[model samples]
Target: MTELVDIHSRTPKRRANEAMMAKIGKLIWALLLLSGFTRAATAGVLTGELDNPSGTLDDQFVYTLSIQGSFDGSPEFPKVDGLDVAVGGKSQNVSIINGKYSHEVQIQFILSPQKAGNFAIPPIKLTVDGKAMETLPLELLVSASGSPRLPPSASGRSGAGAGAGAGAGAQAQGDTPGLFIERKFSKNTAYVGEAIGVNVKVFSRIKVVGAQKDFRYPSVFQVKDKDNQKSNVEVVNGQEYNVTELESVIIANREGEFTIDPAILIARVAVQRRSRSRSFFDDLLGPTDLQEKRLRSESQTLKVLPLPTAGRRKDYSGLVGAFKLSGDLNPRESKVGDTLNLSLILEGQGSSSGMADPTLPFDTKLAKVYKDKADYHEELDAARGIDSTKTFRYAIVPERSGPLNLGQVTIQVFNPLIATYEDLKFDMGTVQIEASGAVTSAPLSSASTPTAGDTAPAADTALPKPEQKAVEVMAKDLVEPHSQSQLRGSDIITSSDWTNGGLALSLSLIGLVSTGVLAYRRKPETENARMQRANKAFKHSKKHLDFAQQCLRKQDLPQALKAAQTCFKDYTGAKFGVTSASVTLRDMESYLRSRSVSRETLHELREVWSALDQMIYAPPLGQNPTRGEELLTKSRRVLEQMERQCGRS
Candidate 1:
């Protein structure tokens, strides 16, 4: 055999330097994981399932009921046909998610099949804290021991995290152990510039408290991670495993066949020490060692096809997906030189980077338009890939008075499914412009060419320019003019030196007196300004309500609800001198109660507030503008009530 090479050996100092560099790399890797973790946190949820739906007469199985959400009491398992069930063990998990405390409890039941047969477990119902909750009906099937049931699917694929439960070790006797990671692509083939969803799942039979992952893939455009990842319990080969998913999107930049490399995950898993004397109680409170495991996902291949050039449109921005665009003018009425915020919101599922902000088609002669900026926000949906919204805010300044027409706005998108281009159009309609309140001494620029400062609201005085009156003297004339006397009179000190000195002293005294009068006048004006701000709270809230109603008319429910919610928060903050973010429902109630608001009124107001919160945060109702309209109305009523009780009091 050939002698092995020893080229890897290094000097002592070099080795030390390498070790130090490795430590620094590990620290950076840990920090990156922590940063990604905070941005993807989600609130709690509840779920239940049979750990192993399919097993043999001699196999081990379990039914797990997990409550990650807020619950006061435990759920009692009910009887199911053809199966004997008993409480086996309980586990509690406490973790910090995004700086907030999160606690979850899982109750496991030992499931033993009574004669090998198919069985249906009826819905398990329970009353927790006076709230009725129930789990979905589950199905289980068992076979004879001699003919072991080939698990529901190919039983075993192993990697890291979790151990075999009970006799699960015996059932999957010859399979690999540890946590298993699997990758599934949404589509095996895609058109050029099409977006594809990439999902990777880490399945573990043991508890995986923490994990760090890195994914490698071929060239793509604008790959973005999903906003949140969720974990749930799944069964594999008569064993219960916790399943956590990692989701992302990859854009096909060019047409060709590409193979994505395996993604890797480093997980921290707890391994229990199994003993013949160990009981369910011992298992619940048993000693376990935390071990780090490395898992790699199976590589996947994708085929990207070139788009047909025949149907391409000039305005197509290489975007592929189902998308729609709509726009509306904010504060529809404006002064001639005032900047009008023209907002265009484009929302749908597609390649985010492919859709560039379309150039506005507004007639420059009527109004000068320039893009302020664009904002992109997205909420991940497993089915649609992503719910993406891009908002383009353009500042428009009207050059001419009267109803200035910004004309029509339109966007073009490519639909990969149909191999065609879609033109989404929006009518921008006319906006009334009141002549600018202030007059300028200089000639005004044409609408097609706004002045440099026109992109923002004019900082000129709103009260208009002061009249330029010619004075009888310049700075040099501040002195009594040196005698412009005729040759004889001018020669002599035509004006007395004492006269010039006295005149200067008198002028100085007048200036000082005027300054004193102005200073005295500002004292009560200062107090009035303070009071004015407090009095305008109700007005500002009402203005927000109006804005919400406008959004509702445009069928933008999310924006409308947000505006309505802001209306309430702003009113409370301004009136109570508290931070808007600190105003909560309970805080508002306490403040109102102190104001002597009746209990009945408070209760009614509470209902409205809760409904607004639900609609704004977790809306159960469908995304329809009617529900949004109702919120606007109710929010307006709440603002009106606050005004009636607190205004002018």
Candidate 2:
């Protein structure tokens, strides 16, 4: 009974002791966790990683050292023997997470193996906030016979299952599809002056986030038609890819065999990492990585054959294509001294760069021909390829004409399709001339004399002869000089009298009258005149529209679009008395609505103006010439409506 009572008495004390010990243990654990968190918050971390741990000797891998925390300066990278190490670049990132600030500095190095073997990259040392820090060492294995193997994440595989599938596929095929380029010509053989199309295409099965290309053709050939290049997505060999195609017209100037060098393309591909268990801090501070790849295409050879020399004509202007020649005389019949305008046009399919002025065999004795500079216009037509036309103007004055025939104009060219030389000619018919009584008034030196083979003159015709005149000579003796005498006082006084009070008074009166007249002539500009001057924007806009039309006729699409846009902006600004630079499309809309512009007119104006703005900012590919013409017409109509509305206002 005493033992039971003692046990009951000790129970409460034992229970209290146990509770106190448990409280003490909990406090100690809390202190430990807090201490650990504070250390982590203050401490810095350094780590090293590899882009690909295993690769071939021909392949290059990236080695990166990342330091997280405050650092004194940049880290010092260590070197390894039998390896080429180059500094790539550096990047820094800063973030504040959960009330804690963190910073990360990453240094990248490109490692190229000189020989096939296992290499060890030593730790990199860095100074961080007056403390020493070092990155962990890394290892790389390079082989000579096998292809490089990228990490599963870098290879775009998600997990172990995907990695296994990739491994099995690689075992089956020995390699994976990669980026490549293909270059080819439309024709392997072409004539010396014929244009051959060349295409450079880049095909890649891998996902490319960014890319740059360097393409070069032989300098010996002339390049044309470069604006036809294209970029888009395509599928090849049952795999999707991004394809960029570059098209150019190449013309070989000389006959020879030439080889085109390979083109290089570099692409930066995004690499997605496999997901891993992370804390809230890590989720907020992860890195995004990208891989770069360089690819090249095979060279191409071309054979340029010389143009045929057989059946070549005398008037062959070194042009190689089908061509046509035409001529027109403004006035077929004119007086002796009247000037006649003659126009000769040469049009063809050959490159205009090689086209020269056509030679004219004019009869100088019949007329004085003054040739002007030839104007050459070339345009690229979507349907007809490249077409060029050259116009030459001549002013002819007939000395004496009756059924006189101006010689024929001829142009020779080699037609590659027909495999022969062609002679294009235009015969100038007879031109009649009436007698001008002012023949004698014409300059004698301006007359054209007959050439060696010119027709003989009529027997009754009289030629002008030089006139000679004789002059009589005579001599006269000098008369006796008058005696010298002193000037009289009265004569001196008379000469000085003009400078007296009367002259001064007259000059002052003239000055006052002139000042008043000048002041009266200079009138102050009124508000009405200012408004009228502002309204001149209509005329200015018309001038811009005219310029746009001229550019459209010349096939200058960029300039035409720019001028058209300027026309509308200037007209709107001037009509509203606002600066053109400050006027937006919305402002124009408001102004038009206030003026009670028709809905149809506003809609048409919006369409035309939007099209013009788009063309000015980003020109469309393969632009049809008709589009420019239509835009020009619409712009003219809108400007006219605005002008009429302004007049009404």
lDDT of 1 by residue, 1-649 (tens): 2233343444666789999999999999989887765433334445677645776664446677766546665677788777778786677665553454445566777677778888887776665334566778888888875353332233443434233221111212101154667656666777766667766666666676655565666646446667467677766666777777667777777888777766666555665532212234444566453444445544557788887777677776666788888887878898888998888888887756446677777678888888876898776543355567888888988888899776777676777767787888888887899888777455555864557886654667343656888776645645455544534643565348879988999999999999999989997897676577668888898988898888888877778887877877887777666787778888877877777767866776786776666566541213434456776777777667767777552
List per-prediction Cα lDDT, in the order shown: 0.66, 0.68
**Model 2 global lDDT (CA atoms, 0 to 1):** 0.68
Return the top candidate by lDDT: 2
Model 1 residue runs over 4 Å out of place are 1-178, 266-268, 272-294, 330-335, 432-649
Tens digit of lDDT per residue, candidate 2, span 1-649? 9999999989989999999999999999989987876666566877788877876664667777777767776566677887998787676666655545566777778787899889998988877655787767888888873343421112442321222211121210011145555555656776788766555555556666655554566767876645554677755434555666655567788898997765555556555432221235446544355555545554567888898878876666787766788888878878888998989888787665655666557678888988888888765532233577888888888898576678787777888768788888888877888887655545546246677887777777757566877775575666555433544445344545767867899999999999998777664444455576567878888899899888888988779888988887888877776788777778887887888877777888887987776556431322434567888998999878867765732
The top-ranked prediction according to TM-score is 2
Q: What is the TM-score of each candidate against the true structure?
A: 0.41, 0.49
Candidate 1 lDDT (Cα, 0 to 1): 0.66
RMSD of each: 33.1, 22.8
